[model samples]
Target: MNFKKIMQKSMGFYFNFLSFVNPKKLKKDGFELFCNPFARKVKPHQLEFLQKGISDVLDLEGYQIQTYKWGSGSKHILLVHGWASHSFRWKNYIEHLIKNDFTVYALDAPAHGLSSGKSIHVVLYAKVINAFLELHSEIKSIVSHSIGGFATTYFLDQYKEHTIEKVVIMGAPGEASDFFDFYKETLGLTTKSLNLIIDEFYSQLGKLPSYFSSAKFAESIMVPALIVHDKNDLATNYYYSIRLNKHWKNSELILTEGLGHDLKSKELVKQVTEFVLN
Candidate 1:
């Protein structure tokens, strides 16, 4: 077998074997690993382009998150990147927002970019956004990619006082349960292990993953939203965006052909700028 298959088999064996010896401990450990995965390392070259921004770190709860501020405009916009992503991923969007006379703020989630952590999840990711909003309440719009999109909705659902005028969710999963399923499948988690992990998650988070649906969160948000999903996206299904658009009362859905997950299209960028500003 190849490396991936071998690793999957090894994980299955390890979890199954541990279930007999110490199931409780295995559940706890597995849940932690499932939730707090090792962050993808940021490359050195990525930092070279970030030299123009004002950078700072925020110590929140158990995480030290890195944030960047660009532009001097009074009105502010926030850019949120997805899993395994850093603030630098917003380079293109930042330029557009700046050109439109909006100050841009981007953050490296806990365990991402310059942040100090081993693992991160949507709940913690939402907390990071909350922390930033606490200080910069003037933020008028937020543009989020992938998991960050779901986290943004989750934050808006909880904190309604913040006056966010517009939102853009790019290539995000609709349901939190789908993500958990993907996680289980990716790690080759046994049924028992999956159940135990779910139980552990409930115990810690006070809700099942199903309760944290992005579609459900969108239902509660009254602001205008633009959801961009490429039909060929492999990581997240395009149908999820369709479902989300249906739930969001005031929203527009843009379906693209070959852009896939990471949208680098200047046309899409222009569309986003028009949607947010005009």
Candidate 2:
């Protein structure tokens, strides 16, 4: 390589190293930085539309932009957005649910949007679902994404009588234990930093910070699950989908190439409709 190119590369590395070592960056807690473009890592335009829909549905006059909701019905469907995402991310899916005559609810899990709190995990996320289910009834199915997919597995383990009839897991995880490890590697977080994150997470909850592998949940869960994932998704990868199929008692897995992590569309609508009807 040319000397100029080598020097530029060295400077780039130094810049990144300096940023990571900055004390100011480390001292600020999770909530202090409620919405980081880097932390969230993703956003969709549909969020605005969905936020408006939520207000219209509730006939609310104010706007803190509550990104979660309990649809006005016993029989219903649900869509769960991923980590650092607002529930409004499911606008396309919501339209399909309404068109198919399904009352739908979507949750913007803690720290993602209007929901109170900071960064969250599958266990706490599942607890929110459990809390909602206890009050509601006739929940028909779920269409969940990424970490939302992992959280659903936590719920499958907890519910005994199978209140959830069907589930469409889009880019879900197969092994919860592996999730944070992936986060660690992707963000270059040391074991010490990972432990600190877990500690912070614990301070926020009674549940432990582990969403460990529950192949048992898949095997024992009677709900019909459809695992939709992209082969090229750098986030969760495809292993989770394969594992869901392997362990699930009644699941159909579809592996799509070139789609990456965001796999919502007309195809998703059709597949979701078929699963709910069946």
Candidate 3:
């Protein structure tokens, strides 16, 4: 087996062993490991775009969330990238937004990009979104990719009333529970370890993963939104966007093939700009 497979197997064995001796400790350990996302190394080109804007940091809980700003339009737009992704991923999108006379703010979610954190969860991601929203109420729209879309929808639903007028969700997963399944499969968790880890999640979040559904949240949001997904996306299935669109009364759905998860086509940029501007 390769190193990754061997590591997963070892983790499974270790967690199972701990479950027999101290399930609670096993749960704590597993939960911590599960909550943290793997940080990817920043590329030189990514750094170039990240530096194009004025930079600042927002002190959040125990982490420092890095933010970048471009343009000086009074109305602001927020760009939220996905899991293991940093603000620089939206560099091209930011260029398009700026061309439309909109100021843009891109943030490094906790544990991603230059943010200081070991890991991040959807709840914490929402907290970060809310913090920036509170600090910059001028933000009128958001463009989010992958897990970032989930966090943004959660924040909007939980807050109810907000200044946000438009949102674009691209290749976002449908439910939080799906993440647990993927995590369990990735780590090759034992049943005991999985149960313990799930229990710990409930203990901390005060609810089960089933309670956090993007489709459910979308049902209540009246803000105009554009849900874009690629039929061939391997990471997040396009079906999630279909489900979200069903309940989002004011939202539009754009399904594309061949673009895959990173639907960064100039055509998509044009559609997004038109929807948000509309």
| Off by more than 4 A, model 1 | none
Q: Give the TM-score of candidate 3.
A: 0.96
lDDT of 2 by residue, 1-278 (tens): 78866664554344335346752333234213222312252244555565555442221122122334534543488777776676666777776666666777776676656555545656667867765665546676888888788778778887664578888888976664475465455445556555554554455554443545646567768788898899899877797688778888788988888878888567867877788777
lDDT of 1 by residue, 136-232 (tens): 8899899999989989989889888787899999999887678668767877777887788788888878899889888888898999999999999
Candidate 3 accuracy as lDDT: 0.89
Q: Against the hidden reference, what TM-scores do the models get?
A: 0.95, 0.72, 0.96
Number of the candidate with higher lDDT, 1 or 3: 3
- Give the poorly placed runs of model 3, Cα more than 4 Å off: none
- Candidate 1 lDDT for residue 189: 76
Q: Positional deviation of 37 in candidate 3, in angstroms?
A: 1.3
lDDT of 2 at 266: 78
- Residues 202-275, candidate 3: write the lDDT tens digits: 99999888998998888779998999999999999999999999989998899999998888788888998888
Q: Model 3: which ten-residue window has the lowest total lDDT?
A: 183-192
- The 10 consecutive residues of candidate 2 with the worst lDDT sum are 56-65
Candidates' RMSD to native:
1.4, 6.2, 1.3
Q: In candidate 3, which residue pairs get closer than 3 Å at backbone N, Cα or C atoms, i.e. clash?
A: none
